[model samples]
Target: MYIITDQLKENGFSVNRLDQIIKRNNNKRQFNTLEYFCIYIIMENIGLIVENTSYNITAGNIVFLGPQKSIEFGKAKGQDTFIISFSSSFYERSIKDSLFLNSQLFFNYNSDIFIAPFSNIEEMRVVFMDRMENFRKKDKSLYLSAAHNAIERLILDAFLHIPTEEVKKDIKFDYLYCVNKFKVVLQRDYKTAKKVSHYAGELNVTPRKLTEMTEYVLGKSAKHVIIEKLISESKKMLSYTNYTISQIAFELGFSDEGNFTNFFKKHTQKNPSEMR
Candidate 1:
């Protein structure tokens, strides 16, 4: 469900009644969303298709989504969920905590985090219910502070529940810190920054070092990552928009239509037209 923008402006965040939202908007086979970081506490089975990955959500499950991450609902009925959504600005203003948000849970590339049946489930449920009641009361001072605290508590609980191995995994490849940051850089500038050296320069690493870190972390070289991102975007535009190949090519920073066609065919082994 989408965050109601007006409520967010007034309260720095918003909580959606998840069952109501699904009832109102679940007519479609897929509901693709591209806004807000979302946290879902599930009271029953709820399935989700996020990007290309599928998640089976069940009772006592907590699902976290990053901003601009696309997701579609999977078919399951009789589910009750509490969905908390907030903007990056609001979250920062309320808690001043980006560390956990940037950890494996929230904003990492190609990853989403979910927790199942934590020790503080009842505590979290109480906080969520209390926050909802206060929110319905429309007492700004009361609800806003409570809502912020409730969300912060949920985040802390999530951090506490994270597995020891996950922490060790992150520490093992300390270069992963650089790799994740490099991913952010690539995501922001992939269209214009085509060369590995360009991304390496932005991340203040040598091209070879960048490739090595990326391969170590992602199992692909830096150049493959950049090219794959471009190809993925191209596929999206080709499938979803009416833009011609030439238009898509120019829009994606290729010098010419022929160059774009060659790249697409080289990667996909099919012309863009054939794919479309």
Candidate 2:
């Protein structure tokens, strides 16, 4: 395990071996809500649940996760795996890098989990090893920059191997940028601003234009995006917290418990209590 953090702890990065992480957690499967972007390299078969979806990952597989996602690990005894986690502030050196991070390559709102097989497992290992070496450096002068470069290399390598068709070529970068900004704003104001018009007002675009942008880039309506985010947050709270259904509703800015129940059941086909 190698952990490097800034003084404020807002910008930090870490690399840890799978076995060590499990051992540190009393050898139990771990459930985590990531606060940073993460890359998981699996050298053995494993099961993973990302935001309520299960995936079977085998050797040579890599998983990418954006921030605020819930992930549960399955057993992988004697398996070799490495987890690299870094905050956005730690990784973003320029506006281009920030936009790249928000791109579909990493933070795709349409997908819960992104997995791809490494074309060259040894080469991937070398990248992680280099990052670890940078963390081990004592001089500490160029370590942060070197680590950033290593992460950039890893992302670009993954981009190359990910199927070209998976990339959204039809959507221009401007639309993608607007859609990404909408997502960021949606995440920040989901509780208070549940309506599409509110988001459009915040983004300085008309509601119809927002919907057009979201549809162009994500193939989903802006309203659907907002509701999806609300549902996701609702599920997270129900699954991970002891809050009652009514409290959860209030927290999510619902007018009343009954309204929330109707909305939840309409979308999920289950009551909030049933989900809990």
Off by over 4 Å in 1: 1-5, 23-35, 94-96, 110-124, 135-138, 161-225, 228-276
Q: Against the correct fold, how does model 2 do in TM-score?
A: 0.69
Can you list the residue pairs that collide in candidate 2? none
- Give one digit per residue, the lDDT tens place, for model 2 in 1-276: 122334216437766677766776677665453457788888888888776667889888788777666677887773478877887778877866765676655676657666767767777676676655656575454666666776786677677765667676555666776777687667667888988999888888899999999898778999999889989889988997899999999999999999999999999999999876
For 59-130, candidate 1 gives per-residue lDDT tens digits of: 777777665555666655533567788765666652235555555666544454455455555665667876
- lDDT (CA) for every model shown? 0.70, 0.74
Candidate with maximal TM-score: 2
The TM-score, computed over Cα atoms with residue i paired to residue i, of candidate 1 is 0.62
TM-score, one value per model: 0.62, 0.69
Candidate 2: segments with Cα more than 4 A from true spot: 1-11, 22-34, 94-96, 161-178, 181-193, 197-213, 229-276
lDDT of 2: 0.74
